[model samples]
Target chain A: DAGVTQSPTHLIKTRGQQVTLRCSPKSGHDTVSWYQQALGQGPQFIFQYYEEEERQRGNFPDRFSGHQFPNYSSELNVNALLLGDSALYLCASSLEAGLTSTDTQYFGPGTRLTVL
Target chain B: AQSVAQPEDQVNVAEGNPLTVKCTYSVSGNPYLFWYVQYPNRGLQFLLKYITGDNLVKGSYGFEAEFNKSQTSFHLKKPSALVSDSALYFCAVRPHGGYSNYQLIWGAGTKLIIKP
Candidate 1:
């Protein structure tokens, strides 16, 4: 009964650099979503992937992107990082969206990103 | 646009005292509300959600939230507080339609401090 897991507990990058974070969803879960948490702020949704396709996305700019593997693992890629990009990148997993199942999402420990 | 509001930036309660965290939401259709708690340097953990049916939803760590549709509120509550309960609490909303329907609209978060 493994829960959601993320890789690289922390990372440091510079301006205009790109960074990739990984996430393995909880067992029995199929959908994966990404979020960004700035200092002292709540998380903001980035995007969600299901069936290896992006199903939804937030108001983020084009620099932020993601991918979901067939095994339900996911990766969040951010290009041209700025100082404002320094934040905690969180990964959450949930069931397929619909009325038939509960939509509760389980999260991972998250990776702290520092844009130097 | 869907949104959530946590009016209180912080809440302080004595150990063994009752606690409450207020939340309000703005959505077009039936609101799907959720409560999550985050510890220091950690990711958000699901507390409970109100999709339909009972307004009183009980969740992890003795946490409970009441969904008041008329007031557009979902406030978290507990009979007695513990020092371990101190953390950051967030309220979120799930939109019913559009491309971002599966995404969550997050609040600014409220820090709960239970004094021992």
Candidate 2:
């Protein structure tokens, strides 16, 4: 059973440029969530996708958006990126429980985005 | 407001010594807590979770957490520290009843260094 997987382990972009990070959830998982972790900080919730629709979002702006494919894979798109966007973008997957209170999220290696 | 806090920025311990990473949380109702670890340049790994039963929850890599309802704390503990166990430890809490899209509230993270 493969765990969550992400692509483009590292990326570089300049301010105002756009970037897309990808993630494949673990087998048998139906929900995907995105998070951003800056240096020396804990991860902040970005948003969560369930049944191909955004079920919940955090305090992020409109520039940060995501999509969940039919296969349960996900993509996080950041538009008009800024230097402050340089951080580790993490993707986590979990089984879709009616109540996620007990769900444990499996994470991928994450993409390191460096916005210059 | 729901939140998690890792008061210590970093913790240093000698190999073979037992170690503990502190975490405290505040939420409106019963708190669903979790512990995750991240190695250098890697994604966060689920260590353990606390839901309804068992105040002491054991997880991967011989990690365990004790949930104290009175103190509202869930502290990660290891029997013996290993250099390989050194990593960034994070504490997270699921909002009461997972009503808010199951987004997790995270702490600032604590860097653990096990000296060999």
- Error at A51, model 1, angstroms: 0.4
TM-score of each: 0.96, 0.96
Whole-model lDDT values for every prediction: 0.91, 0.92
Residue A92 accuracy (lDDT) in model 1 = 95
Q: lDDT tens digits, residues B19-108, model 2?
A: 999999988689689999988888898999988898999999999999999999999999999999989999998876635648888999
In order, what DockQ does each candidate have? 0.67, 0.79
Model 1 lDDT per residue over A36-62, tens place: 999988889999999999988888999
Stretches off by above 4 angstroms in model 2 are none
Q: Per-residue CA lDDT of candidate 1, range B1-116, in tens?
A: 56788999999999999999999988887867899999998888999999899999999999999999899999999999999999999998887643337878899999999999
